[model samples]
Target chain A: MILHGYFRSSAAWRVRIALGLKGLTARQVSRHLRKGEQAAPDHLALNPQGLVPTLEVAGQGALTQSLAVLEWLDETQPGPRLLPADAWGRARVRALAQIIACDIHPIQNLRVLQYLKREMGQEQPAIDAWARHWIATGLAAFEARLAEPAAGRFCHGDVPGMADLCLVPQLGNARRFGCDLSPYPRILAVEAACRALPAFMAAAPEAQPDAE
Target chain B: MILHGYFRSSAAWRVRIALGLKGLTARQVSRHLRKGEQAAPDHLALNPQGLVPTLEVAGQGALTQSLAVLEWLDETQPGPRLLPADAWGRARVRALAQIIACDIHPIQNLRVLQYLKREMGQEQPAIDAWARHWIATGLAAFEARLAEPAAGRFCHGDVPGMADLCLVPQLGNARRFGCDLSPYPRILAVEAACRALPAFMAAAPEAQPDAE
Candidate 1:
């Protein structure tokens, strides 16, 4: 299998961590999202979404969406389970993941930022503010969720699970946008815990082949 | 199971249809979002995110996030799978749902609209324009995905699956924002097909007890 990805993309970074957690390796295929490489005919053919982190599984075919790709990796590979065994615990973990994946990350992605600048003709200050605004708002809710007793060293339990895979990448994006992280103390603590793991550190965007 | 929801929330509506499709009935608890009911202390205790459609199962406490709740409903209730069995097919279907659930919905949610009014002091007209802009961009990509031959009458092969559940609620939202639907012929067609289904029709906001 080959993983087509860009270093800066949180979505791609997510899949990388999941693969590492499972002790599985895939050949890396760098796609420069910043340079419009994703929109090229070849890449578009693989993923009509024109997004990075499309997994080219040898016989199974390609998988898109970081959460989906991660779920696939967890189910297909044997290692530390990314999710809890019980249904209720699984629901909590998935809900935590979606809080970041669905609620926080999407609104502040690069594409939306570009649209704000180009299509809406918003100035840089406005765009930056826009990014921070959504991040701050979403993170506030994330922090509240983590305040629960269910949150241990990580978002859910002691060991890093599915939610950790998502939180790290999104926090990276948050820092890149210079959003204030002070409001989310629990989130910061969780990020620190996740980063200590070799798998998460190995999957860092800076550790990727496409890192600038 | 019991569902804490509002009549007009798309996220809540998605869970409503999922529950109906799975052949389970949950006691419907209404939280009128526009009236700040979701923000009340009682509601926040159930869902820290202050989002509607937090599912309270007879045995399973409270499950927040529509996607998570839907998955739990699938696992517990027998008949009619919400997701595909195979990993690759599952990934494809999930990515389609995220395209709307993550990419489209968050930016146009009620909280974001309130932020535009209170934070940036943007006028109603500009705020409405912002909502329309994000929805059109997302729906365009949604339409592109639907054009793939894998798509049948619905988002995937014929039956209204998870993606279709997401799509229908979002289309209801898009229409509420008064978006121009002409550009998205395929999306409209799929939604039309979805509306024809009894499950989708029964889950409409206006069909709910608290819809006023």
Candidate 2:
């Protein structure tokens, strides 16, 4: 499999952690999102949405969307389970993941920020605040969810799972955007625990070959 | 199951279609989003994110996030499968669904628009343009995905599956935002096909009790 991703992309980071957890290796293909290489025609051909972390499977072809790709990897690959075995538990994990992937990240992505500046004539401070607002709000909710009995050392249990994959990357992005993390001690602890794992550690943006 | 949702929420609409397609019934509980009822203490207690259609099942507790609820419904409820049986096919349907659910809708959701206007001082026209931009771009990619060999009458085959459930609601939103839909003939065709189904028709926002 070939994983087309950006080192700093939260979505791509989720996929890399999933692959590493599953003990699977994919050839890394970088699309410089800063240079708009993801929107290039060739990349768009592989991924219609022109997003990163598109997994080109050996036989199944290219799978876009990090959640979809991660779910596929979890189901098909034989390794530690990325989701819980029960239906309700799975739903809890997925909801937690989507809280970050769907609710927070999309609104704060590069394209949206660019649009706010170029098209809407927004200044940098407003954009930064925009990023912080969504991140802080979403993380507050995430922290609340962690208070549930289902949450343990990780977002699901004592081990890292899909929700942890999402939470860790989102925290990385939040810190990058200078969001206040003091309000989310649970999230911070979860991030620290995830970073201690080799799978999550190896998939960190700074550890990637594409990192500047 | 009881679904806490607003008539106009695309996320809620996705779950409604899922329930309709599965031939399952749920007590519909309306949360007036524009009036900020979803942020009420009771609603927030049930759904920490305060988003809807939260599925409160008999034994499973409240499940938030439309994608998570939909997946849980597919797994626990017996009916026409929302996802394809094959792994690759399921990935395709999920990717198509996430294209709209994660990428398009989140960026244009009511809360985000409110933030843009009240917080960032963006005017109504600019906010509408922002909605249209994400909708048009996402729909264009959705159209491209439908051109794949796997696509048939709907996003994935002739049947209205999970992707179709997501597609119909997004189209409703796009039309509401005054986006130009002329460029997406394939999407329009799929929307027509989906709307032709009783399940999809019954799930339309206009058919809901809370639609104002």
Candidate 3:
């Protein structure tokens, strides 16, 4: 397996954690997002969206989209399953994950920030504020969800599952953008529990091969 | 089943199509997004994010997030399955869906546009441009993905699956924003195919009880 990714991409970080949890190693192919290497014709051919963490499985072709790739890994590989066993539990975990992946991360990603700066002519402070706002809002909701009975040591249960996978990377981005974390104790606790595992520890952006 | 949703919400529209495809009907509980009804205390208790469509199943509690709800409906209900049977094919379909749901739609949703206009002090034309930009960019990638051998009359095969559920709604938004659709012939063709289905037609926002 070959994983085409950038060091600091939260989406790629999610995939890395899944691989570690699955005890599977993929050859790393770094795409320097800042240098726009992901948009290179070859990479674009692999993923039409030209995003990172495109997993080239042995024979299954390339899987793009972090959640899709993560779910695919969970389905095909034998390891700690990322989702719950039942339908309702799966829905809960997926909703938690998508709250970050869909509602939060997409609005504050690098490209959107760049658009705000370049196209909208927003200053750095405004851009940072925009990022922080979405992160804080989303995390508050996540924290509330975690306060529910379904949440255990992790986002779903005693085991770190899909929601934890998403929460850890998002908190990474939140910390990077200097967002206040005081309000989200549940999310912070889940992050701490997830980081205690080798999978989450190994997948941190600073631990990646391409990290500056 | 009762669905708390805004008529024009692309995410909610996806679930409506899935419900129709599954031959299930839900009582319509409209949340006027522009009026901030989704953020009401009662709705927030049901969905922490205060977004729609939140499906209130008979025994399962309120399910949030469109993709999560769509998948849950697919899992628990009897219908023409929205996902492909194979893991690889499922991954492909999901990746296509997320390319819109995760990458495109969230960034251009009503809240984000409101942020751009009110907080950022951008004008309507600029906000419209931002919407068109993300839609066009995402649709171009979607079109390319459809060009792959795995793609048939629909995003995966001849069946109108999850990807098509996402595509048709997004194209509707694109057209509403006055985005030029000429570049994505494959996407348009797929939209036409999907709209041909009674499920998709019935799920159209205009057909909803709260469309006004």
| Candidate 2 error regions (>4 Å) | none
Specify the poorest-scoring 10-residue window by lDDT in model 2 chain A. A52-61
Clashing pairs in 1: none
Interface CA RMSD of each prediction in angstroms:
1.7, 0.5, 0.5
Model 3 spans with C-alpha error above 4 angstroms? none
Candidate 2 interface RMSD (Å): 0.5
User: Fnat of the models, one by one?
Assistant: 0.72, 0.91, 0.87
Evaluate residue B124 in candidate 2 and report its C-alpha lDDT on the 0 to 100 scale. Answer: 94
lDDT of 3 at A6: 90
Please tell me how candidate 1 rates in CAPRI terms: medium
Tell me the whole-model lDDT of each prediction, alpha carbons only. 0.86, 0.93, 0.93
lDDT of 2 by residue, A1-212 (tens): 99999999999999999999999999999999999999899889999888897999886689999999989988899999999999999999999999999999999999999999999999999999999999988999999999999999899989899999999999999999999899888998998999999999999999999999
Candidate 2 residue-wise lDDT at A164: 96
lDDT of 1 by residue, A48-137 (tens): 778887999887667777888887788778999999888888889999899888888887888877866775567788777888877787
C-alpha TM-scores of all predictions: 0.93, 0.99, 0.99
Question: What does DockQ give for each predicted structure?
Answer: 0.66, 0.93, 0.92
lDDT of candidate 3 over B144-164, digit per residue (tens): 999999899889989998999
lDDT string for model 2 (B33-125, tens) is: 999999999999999988887989886589999999999999999999999999999999999999998999999999999999999898999
